[model samples]
Target: MTTLAVPAARFHPLRDSATMLRRNLRRMVRYPSMTLMLVAMPVVFLLLFVYVFGGTLGAGIGGSAAGRAEYANYVAPAIILMTVTATVQGTAISIAMDLTEGIIARFRTMHIARVSVLTGHVVGSVLQAVFSLAIVIGFAVLVGFRPTAGLGGWLAASGFLVVVTFALVWLAVALGQVSKTVETASNLPMPLMMLPFLGSGFVPTDSMPTVLRWFAEYQPFTPIIETLRGLLTDRPLGNEPWIALGWCAVIALGGYLWSRKLFAREDDR
Candidate 1:
C-alpha cells in the first residue's frame, strides 16, 4: 500500500495583511461620519489660520502677494503634516477599541499571521492620512498656495509624507497596546498632534525665543516640516530630508518592536 503525502499549508504574511487591510478599510467605509469629522478639523484650522491670522503672519514672513497667499504658502506644509498627525490618532483609538471589545483575543485564536492584524491598522491609517493630505493640499491651492516643485519633487515629497505617516501610525499602534481603554488611547496620541505647534511649522525658528528656537531646531517634526517645505516650495533641501528620514526609521522600528512585544505579552495572557 502506497501512503499519500499531504502538503503543509503555506502561510503568507503579505496576503494575510492584505486581507486585514480590506477588513479595516471596509469598517472605515461603513462608519463614514467619524472619518469625515477627522477630515473636517484640519480643514477648519486651515481656514481659520489663512483667513483670520493670514494678514499679520504673512506680513511678518515678508512675501509679495496678498497676505493670504503668502501665509497660505508658508502654512500649507505644516497643515499637511498636521493632517498626518491628526489621522494617526484614529489608529490608536481603533486598536484600543479592538483590544477592549475582545476582538484581538478572538484574532489570537485564529490561524492567521499575527502581524497582519497590526498591519491592517497601520495601512488603513496611512491611507486615511494620504486622503487627508490631498484634501488639505487641494484647499491650500484654492487659497493661493502654489507649489513650485517639479514632478520629481512632488513625488519625493509624497514619499517623505508616507514615511512620516508610517512612523507615527506605528507609534500609535504601540500606544494603543499600552492603554487600558480606548479613551486613553485616543488621548495619548494627542501629544503627537500637538508637536507640530512646538516646532517651526507655523513660524520661523529664527523668530522664536533662543531656547524655544533651539528646541524647535532639534525636534523631529521641525526637520520633517522643513524638508516638506523645501520639496514643495523650492527651498534648499539642506540636510533636513536625510534627518527626517532617519527620524522616521528610528521611530517606526522602535514602535514596531514595542508593539510586537505588547501583542505577544497580551497573547500569552
Candidate 2:
C-alpha cells in the first residue's frame, strides 16, 4: 500500500494538471466571445498604428519615403508583446471566476493535486497567447510588416516570447487570486497593457521629452520590447536580452511565491 501510494502521489500532479488544462481549454471554447474580445484589441491597435499613424511615425523614424511599410516593421514587435499582455488579462478574469464561484473550494475537497488548478490556468493561457500571437503576426504581415529574421532568429524570438508569456501569466494568476471580484481582477492587469505605450513601443525613447525618455528607458517593458525587436529584426542585441530575462525571472519568482501563499491561505479558511 505504501509503495503504491508513493507512486500515485508523485504522478497525480501531472495527471491532475493535464485534466485541469483540458477543463480550461473547454471553457475557453465555450466562451468564444471572450477570446475574440481579447484578440481584437491588439489587432485593432495594430491596424490603427500601422495604417493611421504609421506614415507619420515611419517618416519620423526613418525618412519620408519609409512610409507605412517601414513603420509596420518597427511596431510589429510591440504589437506582439501587447498580444501577450492582452491574453494574460483573460487569465486574471478566469482565475477570478474560479475563485469567486466556489469552484476552488470544491476542488480543495478533492484528492487531486492542489497546484494543478493554477497550473491548468497557466498552461491554457500560454497556449491561447501563442495562438493569438500567430493571428496578430499574420495580420501584421498582411499589412506590410516584414521581418528579416532567419530560422535561428525566429526560433530564438519564439523561445523568448514563450518565456515572457509564462512570466506574465503567473503574475496574472497572482493578481486574480487577490482580487475581490472579477471586475477588479480584469482591471488589475490593465496597466500591463499600457506599459508598451509608456515604453519604447510606438516611438523611440530618445524622441520623448527628457523625463519621459528616462522613465521609458529604465522601465522593464522597454528592455523586453527592445530585445524582442532586435531578435525579430535580426539586429544586434547587446545587453537588452539579459536585462529582459532578469526582469522576467524576478516577476516569475515573485508571482509564484505570492500565488502559493494566497492559495494556501485560502485553503486554511
Candidate 3:
C-alpha cells in the first residue's frame, strides 16, 4: 500500500491538474456570456479611443497628419494590457464562485492534488487571455493600427504578454480567495482595470500633473505597457522590460504565497 501510494501521489499531480483544467474549460463554455462581457470591454475601449478620441490625441502625440492612425498604433499596447486585466478579473470572479458554491469543499475531500485546483484556474485564464488578445489585436489592425515588429519582436511580445498574464492570473487567484463573496472578488480587481488608465496608457505620463505623472511613471503598469509598446512598435526599450519583469516576479511570488496560505487556511477550516 505504501509503494502504491507513493507512485499514485507522484503521478496524480499532472493528471489531476489536467482534469481540473478541463473542468474549467467546460465551465467557460457553459457560461459564454461572462467571456463575451470580459472580451467586449477592451474592444469597446479600443473603438472608443481610436475613433472618438484618437484624432485629437494623435495630434497631441505627433501631428494632425498622423491622426487616428498614429493614435491607434500608440494605444494598442494599452488596450492589449487591458484585455489581460479584464480576463483575469473573470478568473477572480470564477474562483470566488467556486469557493462560495462549496465546490472547493468537495475538492478538498477528493484525492486530487490540492494545488491542481488553483493551477487549473491559472492555466485556463492564461489561455482565455491569449484568445482575447488575438481578437483585440485583430480589431486594432482593422482600425488602422499597424505594428512594425519582426518575427522575433512578435515572439518576444507574445512571450512577454504570457508572463504578464501568468502573473496577473495568480494575483487574481489570491484576490479571489481573499474575497468573502463573488461581488467582493469582482470589485477587488477593479483597481487593476483602472491602472492602465491611470498609468501611461491613455496619454503620455509627461502630460499628467506633477504628482500624477510621478505615480504614473513609477507604477507597475506603466513599465509593462511601455515594454509591450517597444516590442510591438520596434522602439528602443531601454530598461522598461527588465523593470516590467521584476514587477511581474514580485506580483507572481506574492500572489502565489498568499494563495497557498489561503488555501491551507481553508483546508484547516
Candidate 4:
C-alpha cells in the first residue's frame, strides 16, 4: 500500500496581525472614553499655554500682536508633540492590562502567530497618536498658531510626526511588557511625556541656564520639536531633522528588541 503525503498549514504573521489589529480597533471604538480623555488633555494644554501664559511668553518672544503670533507658532509644534506622548499612555496601560489579565496566555494557546498580538497593540496605538495630533493641531490653529510652510513642509512635518509616533509607541510597548500592573504601566512612560518641557519646546534654548540649556539642546525631544517647528514655520532646519531621525531609529530599534525579548520570556514563565 502507498502512503499519501500530508500538507501542513501555512502560517501568516501579517494576516494574523491584521486580524488582531481589527479586534483592538473594534475595542477602541466600543470604549472611546479613554480616547476622548487622551484627546482632551492635549487640547487643554494648548488652551492653558496659549491663553493663560501667552501674554508673558509672547512678550518674551517679541512685544506686539506679532509677539503673540510668534508664541502661538512656536508652541504649536510642542503641543503636537505633547499630543503624541499623551496618547501613548493608554497604549502602555492597555498592553499591561492584557498581560496581567491572562489575555496573552489565551493568545499564546491559540493557533495563531505570536508576534501578531503585540503588533496589534503597536498599530492601534500609532493610529490613536495620529488622531490626537490632528485634534491638538486643529485646536492650536484656532488659537492663532500659523505655519508658514507650504505643501512640502506640511508633508515633511507629517512624516516626522509619523516617525516619532512609531518610535514612541514601540517604547510604550516595551514599557507595557515590563510593568506588572496597568497602573505601573500608565506611570512608567511619564518621563517621555515630560521630556518636552525640559527641552526647548516652550522657550529658546538660549533662554535656559547653562546646564539646562546644554541638555535642552541635546535631548532627543528638542531636535524632534525643532525639526517640527522648522518644517511648519519655514525656519532653518540645520541638522535637527537628521538628529531627530537618528533618535527615532535608536528608540524604535531598542524598543522593538527589548519588547520581543520580554514577550518571549512569557513562555519561559
Candidate 5:
C-alpha cells in the first residue's frame, strides 16, 4: 500500500493579520516607555522650533505675509509633519532590528500568519504617529495657534496630512527592510524631511530665488504644506494641494515596489 501526502489549506491572511495586531497591541502596552519616547521627542522638537527658533525666524514664521497670524500658527503644521516624519525613523529602526535579530525568522516558524508581524508594526506606528500629532496640536492650541478653518476644516486638513503621513509609512517600511543597520533606517527620514522647509512650509515661494521659487512651487512638500495651511488657516486651496498628492502617490508607489523587492531579497537569504 502506498500513502500519499495531502497539503493543508492556507489560512486567510486577514485573520492572520488580526492576530498579529492583538499581539502588537499587547506588546505596545508592555513597553510604555518606548511609546512615550516617540511622542515626547516630537513634542520637544515642537518647543524648540516654537520658542528658540521663533524669534530668529521672525514672529511671522519664515516670513509669511499673514502677519495677523502668530509665528506659532505658521509653524504648527510643520511641527505636526515633523512629528509624523520623526516617528518614521523609530518605525524603520524597529523593523530592521526585528529582521536582523532573527525575531522575524522565529515568527516564520509559528503557525500564525507571517504577515501579521509586519502589519502589527505598521498599525502600531500609525497609532503612535496619531498620538504625536495630538501632542503637537495640543501644544499649538495652548500657545495660541488658532486655526481660522474651524473644527470641520481643521479635521479635513489633519486628514490630508495624515494621508501624506500614510504614504510616508510605506517608504519607511521599505527602507527598514532594505537597510542592514538600524542607523541607516533611522537617519534616512532627515533628508526627505527637509523638503518642506525648502518648499512653502516655512517661507513664501514667490519671495525665494527664481530657481528655488520654481522648485518650491512644483515640489510635493509645497503643495502639502500649503494645502494644510489653507485648511488650518482658511487660505485658498492652491494647486499645491493636488501637486502634493501627486508627489505622495508617486513616492508611495515607488517606495512600495522597492520595499517589496528588498523584503523578498532579505527573506530569501
Candidate 6:
C-alpha cells in the first residue's frame, strides 16, 4: 500500500482558493435568489435606517437627512463591510452544520481536500462581499452621494474594504466552528458588526461622552472609519488604515488557528 502525503504548502497563497470560489460562483448563478437574499439583508438594514430611523438618527450623525447618500455616505461602506462580517461566519456554520448532521462525515468519506471545503466558503463570501458593496454603492449613488474622491479613490476604498472583509471571513469561520448551533452562527455577528456604531462611524468620537469617547477613538472601528472617511472626502490619511489592517490580521490569524484546532479535534486537521 502506498500513501501520498500532501504538503502543507498546498494551502498557502490559496492555490485552491480560486478554484473553490469559481465552483461557488457557478452555484450562486444557479441559486440567484439565495445570493440575492444574502445581499439584500444588509440593504434591508439600510432601508430600516434610511426610512424608519434615518430622520431622527441623522441629527445624531451630522444633522438631518440620512438618505441613501448623505446618511449612507457615512454608513454605506460600513454597511457593505458588514455583509462580509455577517456572512463569513456562515462558513464556520457550514462546517458545524454539516458536522452536526453527519454531512461532514459524508464529505470526509469521499476524501475531499479538507482545505477545499473551507476555502470554498471563504471564496463564496468574497463574491458576496463584492455584490453587497455594489448594491450599497449603487443605492448611495442613486440617492446623490457622489464620491468626491473620484473612481480611483472609490476603487481604493473598495479594495481596502475587501482586505478587511478578507480578514473577517476567517474570524467568522472560526466562530461558526466554535459555535454549537446554526442559530448561534446567525446571532454572533450582530455584536461585532455593531462595534463600529460605538466608534467614529455614525458620529465623530469627539462628540461622544468623555469616557465613552476614549474607547471609541481607540477601538479597531475608529481606524477603519478614519480610513474610509479620508478616502471618501479626500482628507489626510489617518493612522486608521494601518490600525485597521493590524486589527484584521490579528483577528484573522487567531480565528484561523481556532478553526484549525476545532477541525483537528474532529479527526481532521
Regions of candidate 3 where Cα sits further than 4 Å from its true position: 1-11
Stronger candidate by TM-score (3 vs 5): 3
- Tens digits of lDDT, candidate 1, 163-236: 99999999999999999998899899898878888898888899999999999999999999999999999999
TM-score of each: 0.95, 0.96, 0.96, 0.97, 0.86, 0.81
lDDT of 3 by residue, 1-269 (tens): 35554544453888999999999999888988888899899999999999999999999998767788999999999999999999999999999999999999999999889999999999999998988899999999999889999999999999999999999999999999999999999999999999999998999999999999999999999999999999999999999999999999999999999999999999998
Please give the range of 10 consecutive residues that has the lowest summed lDDT in model 1: 60-69
**Would you list the clashing residue pairs of candidate 1?**
none
- In model 4, which runs have C-alpha deviations exceeding 4 angstroms? 63-66
Q: Give the range of the ten consecutive residues with the poorest summed lDDT in model 6.
A: 8-17
Tally clashes: model 5: 1
Weakest 10 consecutive residues, lDDT, candidate 3?
Answer: 1-10
What local distance difference test score does each model get?
0.90, 0.94, 0.95, 0.90, 0.75, 0.70
By TM-score rank, best first, the candidates go 4, 3, 2, 1, 5, 6
lDDT tens per residue, model 5, 1-269: 99998999786678888777687677768877766776676577667766776665654444464342366777777767777777777778878888888888887777766556667777777777787788778877886578888889978977787788777877888888877888787787776667767877666677799998998788777777777888888988857677878878988788777777776665687
Clash count list over all predictions: 0, 0, 0, 0, 1, 0
Tens-digit lDDT track for model 6 on 49-109? Answer: 6666655666667655443355656665566655665566555555567567776566556
lDDT of 6 at 161: 79
Decide which is better by lDDT, 3 or 4.
3
Index of the highest-lDDT prediction: 3
Superposition error at 236 for model 4 (Å): 0.6
Query: Which TM-score value belongs to model 2?
Result: 0.96
What is the per-residue lDDT of model 2 for residues 174-257, given as tens digits with 9 covering 90 to 100?
999999999999999999999999998999999999999999999899999999999999878899999999999999999999
C-alpha root-mean-square deviation, each candidate = 1.8, 2.6, 2.4, 1.3, 2.9, 4.3
lDDT of 1 at 116: 94
Q: How far does residue 223 in candidate 4 sit from its true spot (Å)?
A: 0.2
- Candidate 4: pairs in clash: none
Candidate 2 wrongly placed segments (more than 4 Å): 1-11
Model 1 regions more than 4 Å off:
1-10, 63-66
> Which model is ahead, 4 or 5, in terms of lDDT?
4
Residue pairs with backbone atoms closer than 3 Å in model 5 (clashes): 223-240
